[model samples]
Target: MRGAKSAKWVVGAVIVALAATACGGDNKDDKPTGAGKAGGTFSLGLVEPVSIDPVNAQESEGILVTDNLFTGLYEPTADGKVIPALATSKTVSDDGKTWTFKIKPGTKFTNGEIVNAEAFIRGWTRLAAKASASDVATPNVGGIDGFEALQKGTATTFSGLTAPDENTLQVKLTTPDFEFDVKTTHTSMSPVPKVAGAGKNQAYNDAPIGNGPFKMSGKWEHNKSITLVRNDDYGLTKAHLDTVKISILNSANAAQLEYQGFQSGQFDWARMPTAQLTSAKAKYTAQNEWIQADTSGMNYLLPITENGPLKTAKARQAISYAIDRDAIIAGVFQGMQTKSTTILPPSFKDVYQKDLCVSCIKQDKDKAKSLAAEAGLKPGDELHIGFNTGGGHEEWVQAVVQQIKDVLGLNVKMDAKPFKELLAAQQAPGATGAYRFAWGADYPTPDNFLFPLLDSKSINKDASGKVQGDNRGRYNNPAFDALVEKARSTKDSAARNEVYKQAEKLAMDDQALIPLWNRTQFRLVNTKKFTGGAMDFHEDPNLAEISAK
Candidate 1:
């Protein structure tokens, strides 16, 4: 889930959520047993989350916490199929701009509050406020009517959202979106209790009362651990595990520590560090203790476009041409990742263009030199590459820096900080030259991948010019924005995908963001002791489905 990475819209964005299996096929063996012996505790090792608040969860760690703490109108299965959870059924208007969902009756939060239509309405309105502030709001409801007014703080509630009855929730969108139900699967679209208030309520965020399969056992312990117990009153698929304990360890070698903990039988689930992936496979594969799943997350470099040494397209293209992704994957990642040449992953088969990034597929020192010189870069100029520490990124980022030095002959430096600090720096205008970032899918659509990360409209700036939107790099292109809009409105999947492909090409040709590699999730699990614990499309474990064997 950490590839939901240092940030989510850096992980969570919305063209609209797409069905994972339809777009990209995952491991067929990924099916976990839904019926298993219950009543066992499952322990996992994890990195610290920035926030567990669904509205503010922008990174992978935070997203994991929210995933367990809440259930939305629709929820995705392990393979990414969107199914009704809080809602039993849905219908669309003739024009396709209006949608009404029938909320499942009698569902209640752990706190005994009813999970009615108002709960979802309040939750979405609160999410809009957070999105307005440039905080992490996913499944961007920007398509909904009155969203702009709500986001701009001009409205107190969403005019598009209305409760016709206690169990009926209706939404009016400015544009027709047939896949709106799929977008409801996001945690950001989950219902929240009244105590969550209308903004960042620290008390509620610390100990959220959820209507999901699990409930927080106590308050979050912050850098230490967070515990969850099964919510017996859950209305949908009930959790089989009695308790889920997530131990947060954020040391410099956190992933290594997690692997060690797994070996010592301290954790039922753990992530394999890149340094030990090969040895882990050798040791665990024979025992069926290792699981490798494909996720839609993409690791890349985000260059500050507004200002910096990477201000020009040629400079960004030069950086993309200089790095050797194969060496990093082979030497640092132990050949566990796939090199990427485009914004969309291969899973988006209908729209993905393999060779769209002409300069990224292979390293070209001559091309790098020419582009660097064209952008007025000299051999000795200092170019800083910033990244988050303690997330198994230091090694690969160092390799990238070395390649840039060797290829462009620049005085490259590494700027490493804590994940939170690095995120802040990346969002600030020109605070750093370039920083590492990754994005995982919320749903399967190309719009989900393209619009939020590249659209100029998605770029919201504060008075001080810091990015408050998902467009952290603050790239502005009227032509690119037009294509994204065209795709957003097109109802036919094939035609829409064509427009999306064009948009992706435009951004890539400009070298808007340097594509590195697609993520392959490596996990360690005690298969003999547990059943039904598997990675979802976002690389998060299906904690609700896990049970003792």
Candidate 2:
């Protein structure tokens, strides 16, 4: 039921295609080309469908397209620094509860809609609307003043948000959030066409309007293809290519397509399969292609539920010890993954605790049995585990389940359902089931990693009036919640680090979740053709400066 914060690597050191195109003739010059000079069409492959609305899109590929199609009020720099995009400058109140932004002049949407303070207000308000069901805004912006109240039917409007003038916008929060600038990088906070925000329907979905580098030219849903043309009217800057096409494909077939050259010039770039890493290196290296290993951006795991046999701390710890992560990473993952000690990846500097727990680093079969015995579990006790097979990766899930059965004496039952159904079941209160899930950092903050999954306040009822199932296991500890909240409010690095240190300890002690391998970002690209901007979790396949050689 866990949503991917960004993208995933299909293989080791095999680069995922950001965008690619083949030209009729090769140009050996290494110089950059002018806008629209690279006239050929580029085709990028995505594993998942781009069904989510652009305003609330969460997938990495979706974000890449959205970035080219829209511009946010602010954009994150390469080093995770925030700089102005739509807004020229911003001022903060002495109390730190209010922020005033000065809108940049001459900013306009692709549909000729003027970019003003009112546009920002309208866009954010629409995102916070209950009808939107926007995953991006619900969890991130709910903390803003009057936002949660509106969602709960206690308030009719966002009293904290005000647009007093055409170019002046003010935002009031319930409390000061030091990471407000970082939070703005999310798509929910990005400005959208005022018309598209009117209602959720085909008009909004079919005709997405934005002020980005590219605009949607055509879409073929059944064929899984989207055509994007350069937004010539975009005032900021022009794109190098005239058109870019994105095609959705099965993960298993992506690498094969690249190797066969079926779409050779059309599919100049692709993510090489991990199984073919040795062959790819031998083949592509001779051609002088770029191949590198990028760190997996987040931690992936199968969380144990509190209402199940894993309710006991010993049982939960025992489950963690039962499966050998090294074997899973080597055999199932082909050494493309790294064992994670902390919930956060090593790429995240401020929040990741390097020395949290050394003993839990490796799996020990004897230790797992001893812990299960301590939990007072007799023979024949059933352990029910759930996983989403429709989202893909059924093989990995089956392997993990088999390993657990072989190592632990407990009887295990597996339920593999479609992602949507499994997600719904996971969120249903009193629904005790363990499932495979992964968490990617929304923003580069410890609070981002700790809050949504663990915080007690995050739990709520769905549209059906049933208890909303964020904390699927009903695992609640006020002390842990308080520690996370403290970290969220503090601006000091040392104070926030100390709070996260304590919070990590509490989470590990309860054994509510298992720490798995940290993911690495991998993408295959024709370096000779396109150039500029390094890839990162925040922005994959930096489209801003990419071009055809």
TM-score of each: 0.93, 0.85
Per-residue lDDT tens digits for candidate 1, residues 51-153, read: 7877766677877778877888876665555666777789988766999999877878888999999999988888887333636452367788988787777
lDDT of 2 by residue, 146-213 (tens): 78776665765677888878888888888766666666756557677667754375666655787776
| Clash pairs for candidate 1 | 2-5, 8-11, 8-12, 8-58, 9-12, 15-447, 15-448, 18-444
Residue 98 CA error for candidate 2 (Å)? 2.0
lDDT of 2: 0.62
User: Which stretch of 10 consecutive residues in model 2 shows the poorest summed lDDT?
Assistant: 18-27
lDDT of 1 at 58: 68
What lDDT would each prediction earn against the true structure? Answer: 0.77, 0.62
**Candidate 2 positional error at 358, Å:** 4.9
